[model samples]
Target: MPDMPTVSLNKAAPPPLPPTYQDPQLLPEPRRCDTGAGIVWIRKAFDMFKQNIGIWLGITVAMFAIMMVLTIVPLFGILSGLVVILFIGSFMQAAAIQERGERLKFEYLFSAFSTHLKPLLILTLLYMVSIAVFFILTFWGMHLLSVSNFLEARVALDSVGVSSSKQWIVMLYMLIAVLPMILLSMAFWFAPALIVLHDMAAMTAVKKSLQACLKNWLAFLIFGVVGGLLSIVLMVFTLGFGFLLVMPMMLLVYYTSYRDIWTDQPLSIDA
Candidate 1:
């Protein structure tokens, strides 16, 4: 067989080989507060707080009202109302962020109710399932102890030839109940991030939220514990001016974590 000449991009010979294409970088540095990314975000959040206070306050009020109703009303189907809120959140939140300069608005959130219903519904189901799991584990653990208490214990031990202390049984159940508090916090730690950043379906956002925490389990658990302790301390000291600091800090932590994992892209400087 004759040896074949190499093809090249040079016009005089064969065309030169095409250049290799490069993909955009993944796993870029997250915008950390130490890098002043958090500072810029703090500024933006300040603007967000200042301009969207009324919107947020109103939404908060509406939500609180719904919660109150759920607690007070029997079979009023308040779970359904919660789905309404999550759906409304999709549009209301985006509009509130975008219209931070507008200062005051009434019907902006109403529009979200109709427009973002699909993703909102998915998120609602996800949230419901997570909450259900949290409660189920909590109650089941409690019941497990109740069944093993006193009379039940005497009956079971007579059959099994073993014994247990009331204190130990109670303590074990307490630990189980408390475990959900931490799991619930971490499980939904990225809920808002998934809802806002990825525009993921509710089930997926919830699952991803759980996975994100598992991947960064220690940090996420520490965040909840420290954040909770600090919030209580601040509440004691500042009569809730603390929320001005607390809310922003909490949001920043989640936002930074989400950016690091999902986007993993550099932020462009403001033009």
Candidate 2:
């Protein structure tokens, strides 16, 4: 029997490991939050806002001024809508930064502009089309109504010593326009966060946002009512200066709601 020689092999350390690729599609589904969570989210946001009110206020004011300037540009005034959507995503990013215990910077105000500008701009265009279609339908409905009641409308106007459908048209448009706009606003509420934070496409974000709203419509309804009242009171008490505080806090609250839903975890007060 011959003894076999055992050879010891030196194994070189494996080349420095490269970063692992993560699955981008592994996003968590949004959780169902209770109606009370709306107020909790608001409180969380206000606490976050208190940490750097001055910076938040400055960012809010700057955003306002930029949007105002954009609004005044002639022949290209429509560009402001796109700018507004981009800024909304930027502001959400800003809130996310603050939520993560990072120092908020002025640059966060433009973060989305660099990262998700095109999709956000397209989101704005979709929003515009939504509104425009609603407006046209409203105008058409009013036209039909006016035609159906032409004689009665004329008699009523003559009784009031007024002539012309212009006033009625304007009134009808105002009344009819608000409902669709509010519905659209709710549906689009979470789209920016979904697009910027989750890296979703415009239409995907819009659809998911709308579905999230529909699923949580009751909570949103309560939040809207209570939050609207709180906003009015805050605005009144601070003589409009509160807007500087309220505006950013509201945005943070919005981001909080989106985070809570999408991540399936509510942020703690201490967080």
* Top-TM-score structure, candidate number: 2
- For every model shown, what is its TM-score relative to the native structure? 0.56, 0.76
lDDT of each: 0.55, 0.79
Model 2 agreement with the true structure over 1-271: per-residue lDDT tens digits = 9999988698777898876633223135566777677777788888878898888888888998887887897866777776888888998888877766679988788999999989998899999899889888878877876679666656776788776567764665577767777778877899998888788899988888877777777777777887889989989998987777778888887787886676644564334
* Cα lDDT of model 1 by residue, 1-271, tens digit: 9999988776677678986533223232222222334344334444555555665556545644666777677786666556554534543344334433344454544454565566666666666776788898778767765866546655665567555656655666678777777666666665654665445566666676676666656545455565678779987899877765665444545544454444543222340
User: Which residue pairs of candidate 1 clash?
Assistant: 8-14, 8-15, 8-16, 9-15, 9-16, 10-16, 122-202, 123-202
Candidate 1 has a TM-score of 0.56
Per-residue lDDT of 249 in model 1: 45
The runs of at least 3 residues in candidate 2 whose Cα sits more than 4 Å from the true structure, single-residue gaps closed, are 1-28, 149-178, 268-271
Which regions of candidate 1 fall more than 4 Å away from where they truly are?
Answer: 1-112, 145-169, 240-256, 265-271
